[model samples]
Target: MTPFEPDRSEDLLNRLKQDDKQAYEKIYFTFSKELLYAAYKKTGDRVIAEELVQNIFISLWEKRQDLQINNLQAYLFGALKLSVINHIRSLVMENKYMEYQMLTYSENHQDTANLVDLHDLSSIIEEGINSLPEKTQEVFRLSRYQHQSTKDIATGLNITEKAVEYHITRSIKRIKEYIKNFYIFL
Candidate 1:
């Protein structure tokens, strides 16, 4: 047997296809740092990036039997890019889902006071709002239930305009999260 050349990725690929553990470790050691850094740069979270890298490499190993890659690094990076894109999309998907839920709840609520009065759901929403931190809950109620302007809320709360906006955004996110959980019960 000729001596193995670590510089030749084709040789590594061949060895990997044969389920050679050492070759797998070599590839992982060679590329894991770069892959991790790439994932982190895109994700902004070390734990998530690390998990993404691990999952990608695990998939590579699992599919080694039939995998044909002329450039393994490129293949892995492509997979990572897709993973990051999907991950980022999932956040938007969550917000979109929350909007859809709120819309559905409102429409159904308005359409059928006779069938199912929204008082019960309103109570749930109220509960979600009440669960917010005191200042946040107060700020949200003033903005939403009271229809007060941001300036009014800020002046009343003795906080800055930006702080009021931040509180409102935080409250909305928390309320949406709570309602999503409440929806599971329904």
Candidate 2:
């Protein structure tokens, strides 16, 4: 109720663990919008922000039975920070891909500035993407390169959205694995 209400967060959390709707609603009302805003600030995409917030709440609920909270705000802020960091990391990888694409575009006209380095990097990345399963590679290109929505891709490919999602997820996992293996040499 009030800001100074002592142990109120704990009580609400306890009630939430007991599957109390009113307590859950209260917690949602008190924190959801702010958390969404924080996630949106980091992601700069409403869809991703909504997913991030939903996941945070779902994870919180799953851990509720054994959850401990010394400071609700601190715990929330920490989660937000981790979500933001993951968002930034994805953005970086996306940007790197965009850079490669732009380089390819410029190559058609004879622009060769930093050509060797760009070619080497692009070759490595291409090998990584190529090593993925054909479905994963197609899904990754459609989603990451062509910037198509999952629904659109699934529709265009005449496949189920869940299958498209699975392919994309597999591609991401393979990419991470590639990066890990490549990093070992460095």
- Best-performing candidate as measured by lDDT: 1
> Which tens-of-lDDT digit does each residue in 82-153 have in candidate 1?
989877886787688667756776665746742453576677688888888999988988998899998998
RMSD list, candidates in order: 14.8, 7.7
Over the stretch 1-186, how does candidate 2's per-residue lDDT look in tens digits?
Answer: 125243988888789789887876677678778888888887889877866676566567668778787767667668878977887886787688667757765664435644754675577677888998887888889999999999999998899885786676556656766665654553
Off-target runs (Cα >4 Å) in candidate 2 are 1-4, 98-186
User: What value of lDDT does candidate 1 attain over all alpha carbons?
Assistant: 0.78
lDDT of 1 at 85: 89
Top model number, TM-score: 1
Ten-residue region with minimum lDDT total, candidate 1: 1-10
Off by over 4 Å in 1: 1-7, 106-186
